[model samples]
Target: MGDENTPLGAPQLAREAKDLVELANTEETVSELLRRGLDWLTRIARFDLATLFLLREARLVAVAARGPLANARVRGHVLDLAAFPMVRQALETRRARAFTEEDHSGEGDPFDGVLDLPPGHSCMVVPLCSGERCYGVLTLDRSECETYPQTVVDLVEVYGQLLATALQNAEQRSDFERLHRQDHEHAKLLESQLGGDSEGVLETSLSPAMRDLARRARQVAETDTPVLLLGETGTGKERLARAIHRWSSRADHPFVTINCAAIPAGLLESELFGHVKGAFTGATKDRAGRFQMAHGGTLLLDEVGELPVELQAKLLRALQEKTFEPVGSDRTVRADVRILAATHVDLQQAIAQRRFREDLYYRLSVFPLRLPPLRERLEDLPQLCAFLLDEQARRTGRRGMRVLPEALARLGAYDWPGNLRELANVLERATILSRGPELGPQALDLPTHVRAPEAPAEKLAEDKPGKVPTLAAVQREHILRVLALTKGRIYGPGGAAQLLGLKPSTLQSRMKKLGIARQELFIIEGPT
Candidate 1:
């Protein structure tokens, strides 16, 4: 080191100040900024060691340190305000103070008791403060016996103030980011609740079966009677339930839904009826349940078959009386909620097996509505594909997306065991795989096992030698002739569907089932 008596040149001091200011303005986490700040001070000031402490809960915790022994153990060191008098005084005075070896009394240096510094060491304490707020104290130690010059003390004081301001800004930024994330999550939740497909399953459904179902659902929607929705998995029972809620008088009120199979048997009761604080192990506060949340609206209990037997009785009571007691609370709460329950389980079988209450089943199935499987309503594929593709395009920012007719035919050929939900997933995948605006057959990755198998030639050739064409063959030949007459047109007036006096969607379903391809229809020369 240079002579303690010699002053730092103005140019050198200006450069040193610039470095400290640049380090303080660095966009980094609070802990990282503090660590780098300490490193710069120790290296520039030529000090043997330096420690930065932050005030937390009336105590100074060593947050960052630089030296041979400045490991995790030293950085984690804590000093109570009452225990470290020099550090407390530095923070209270908002000033920098220097101490030499002669300043210590016989009791020994305060830092020596904690940091285990060598005897005859000099140190300086600078308060990391700005305005009226004091963040903490910065302590710099030197192994030499020389006192710190006034210039070095003043430089450290400026660094401390800059670091303190940076720490405050970093914390504020962290809080702002956290709040923004929470607001984004809340917005998504609200969107899911209110901005879902308004028309629901009825939007593009061309199947007469679905139209009839919608007509019946509208009749029952005006009434508060429990509507039991029965369908296979992925058959859009929840979508239909939402449609019914939208059509009902309570449309303005909240529409709440809960999956009975998703929650555990023990906690599902609390999820349905809510619980008071101290109701269970993790119940730190009171919460509204699905029933209370859907008051004056509709409550959909999805996968109702999975509800535990013990909770079914309480549910039945709530349905019958329009009142329920929350878990761990004796006070009765009443809710005017129109209940809709949906499940794929056969309740009659469940009753036979004594797994479900017969009374509860009758109570829930007051106005039962069954959703037709996709295979049974294959005519809806074209419209459904168009709607789904448009939805996916809008979501993924791919505009004017369309599916080729052959690709749609390929989709129709699959016996979708997972129904509409699976169709949506397949279309979404196709949209992602397609490079152009048009989705072709190559974009579809349908499972080979699920594809509708073609009839063996031997089965069709049975018409030769004491064999007659099967009904399927005759139907296929007739549909092919009709398609040829309409020039492969399946929809609209004067199309093959109209020529055959069949609903367009129904004709498509029959054609798919009969394994009739559009190319074969066009190639047919005045029938086979």
Candidate 2:
């Protein structure tokens, strides 16, 4: 067995190599492959000890051990490159080295304090190398009373080569899986962004301001940065947040929302960070919080300005560390969520008053977007009305419902204090009351309490250049004058509705649809 020329030795080595190749090919996991390889070496090669150390995080880790030390403690033992010179030399030179009693003269013993080599035992360290890279070092030990065969050393070297190939294949497979997962996640986000089966839509088509806002939102949608949406109430901040989620890489995952102001302060922490089964009274079972539920996706923190000061520090820590412990659990869970914060409150003022944390604000406002109010984007009224009227028509069993120019002028004249939400409410009401093909001024009796555009010094100046008074405008003006004359009364005999030849309810609905307010009209009674 010690002579390489022995005819039987070649066939035995060939069979051992074939068995190892089959084992390496069949095992899927790296740990399993190493375990089987060590077992084969200990049994077939008659080694007293066999250990497989693989490179991990720039160090060699004892992934599998057999023979004398087959305990759990030996499996994860980590060896630094500088601590073991024999393993280092084997790895660097890409060659197997043998240490025997006769070869240990002046060197004293390189294996001393390094490996627990049994007394009167010989050892061989083989590099598990393929191509130019060495994956790790394989060590085998046996009694020195019998000569260690050169055939056995060659067989171990061949096994090391096959192990290196297996390790590389396993690593490549892991990389492929990771990339596939990332691609799947990206696809989901794109699908949502493209409005996949979702009722949400960005109304940026009719207004340049909205278009700009959408453009900025799209720019930051692919990143993991926190977004702060600043706008007045009813400006569609939540809708914009949804758009960001759809466009982000995490679109495939959940998009969870939490209204801080709507929830009680006492329950906010548990709601955000989750809790164990016995975290508090009435806690029947464990539940995931919004943060955990929104993992790998977007979390919309609506009215985030309402979060209490004490919770701000916790939130900041989670955002910074990407980890948080459940209410009653000592285990820290990871957070892989993108945050979108929406609020109508003045955060700067809140910070100044010590009601909000400055650090939290900075974290939340990494990319801030301010939505324009409806009054500032009146040019979009026609498109907005068209979309809204279509929605109203669908809801009210009406078809082809179009807004007259006069009705649009009436709508464009007033300041929409409630923004898009108010507009939707008014249009919905008008659709319910309309009995004609076109939505006329009579069908849009706007509230008389909101501010109207300042009247020009003269009636001629109000019309654009050569623009004549359309019947709608004339009707709107007439209705306003009568409402003022009746002191904003709509019901009864002397009411504006009676004078306008309409039912009181129909007239009231029209006023709401028109964005008119009696107080606003009365305020401008003496003006042009």
Candidate 3:
């Protein structure tokens, strides 16, 4: 930026910046840039392992793996964003910082054990964050005993920012590519249903639950009636809604989604039914509501159960009559959208409690699709993990990952009350933290509360110190205890599986394998 022995002036600096920006914006593929970027960081940082975890869906995904990590191709291999204190701080505030081993060791931090590196080396992870979200992190673990200096931190932040942008851009490019490739294939199918005859759905799931959902979605796609999707939190309801749209007559139109719980009640009404210019404070321009934007396509009302009661009647009117006035406008706008709504809550209970409109409920439930929780679909965990890990590897072109069978076994037994979304997060967390060839239970930051109970008091007193039961034994005892407590039910509340950290169906299979019966242990299933 400067002449020999002299400082550069403003114009020269500006020109240099423009040149750098151009270099960054070149048509080189994102994978190439990411590879080169990691190479550069490894040299500059002198670390043993390095990787970048880009956000996908709602979880962090390892797009690039470098340095000393063995076998990087395992699916959903990632870290929990909300669980990492350093990442949480950096991303939420949009500030760059690093964490060392000394900062760990808190009573209830989500980031425990993440910084434990090979040898005597510590770890450093700089967040690749933008706005309120963290796209990924530039992680480095070094064998040297020296603490990181300010210069290294600054360099890591810059590299992390560029890497995150490259990752985000690559994902968008992939989406465009997928849409292009699938659009033609789905033409006949889209036309049959949405009048456009689209047939295929996004390959969002490798799990049987997802495949089944897609199959059932095809049946609902051809109908003109409203559809309601019911599931626990973290289930991919919006993704399902979009799949429905892609196969419907409205395939050529927009698909819009708005979370009822993410917005305030007063402003949500105006957001859904646009306010006139200057209708109230800050209404400076004419705007089209989500409905208008999604006209002729699908309007996904996410978290629909959270809509305020006052607006429930209004929503019902619009659903039935297909017309609505703006918040401050008297003109009635005709709606041509196929309404698709989703909620994690039980709407029947909401209606009974007078928190929802029964008429609206009837209309939406005309075509109902219930997304089974992750626990119900434990049979699909292995496939889903493989798909997600491979997708991440394919995106960033890493070495790929390896998942041990035992790890998968433990994973399938998890309760997954948070559902697929949670399962995805757990896998994502494991991807970033795990090294070498196999993913083990220690790397999986499952809720600490999920650990096994102490031995029964009688057994503990009888045993020698430091001896622990095998995982299977622990699981068996836990199930037996739950069976005694519940009296009997295998699939309902207080069921053996729920009492333990497992799906009911898994418990049943285990019980059958172990030749144990809830009926023999107890006499009742809880009230439904």
Highest TM-score among the candidates is held by which one?
A: 1
Rank by TM-score (best first):
1, 2, 3
lDDT of each: 0.79, 0.75, 0.67
Q: Judging by TM-score, tell me the better candidate of 1 and 3.
A: 1
Write the residue-wise lDDT of candidate 2 on 1-528 in tens digits: 233244235677577667766665566676787777676665446666677887776688877788764556666567777756666777888877776666545344433554565555767878998877778888776655454577767666776787787667666676787898897788666545433322223444544577778778888997888999999998878878877887778767878899999989989999999999988997789989999999988899999999999999989999999899989899999989899999999999999999999999999999999988887766566677777666555556687888775576567666789998888788777776788778777788688777655776896466685476776676676666555445456677656677677998888777777667766555434344
lDDT-best of 1 and 3: 1
Best by lDDT: 1
Q: Candidate 1: global Cα-lDDT?
A: 0.79
> Candidate 3, overall lDDT?
0.67
What's every prediction's RMSD, in angstroms?
17.4, 18.4, 26.5
Error of 1 at 269 (Å): 0.4
Model 1 superposed RMSD (Cα): 17.4
Candidate 1 lDDT tens digits, 1-528? 334455456676566666655654565567877877776665346676788888897898888889765667667778777766766778888989887666665334655545677766778888988767888888878777777888778766776776777667666677887998787577546644543563555744555689889989988999999999999999889888888887889876777899999998998999999999999999999998999999999999999998899999999999999999999899999999999999999989999998899999999999999999988777677777776776665577778878776676567667799898899899888878888888888999899986445779997666466466788887786565455444577788656776667898999889889888766654532234
Tens digits of per-residue lDDT for model 3, 251-276: 77767789999999889988898878
Give the Cα-based TM-score of candidate 2 against the true structure: 0.49
The 10 consecutive residues of candidate 2 with the worst lDDT sum are 194-203
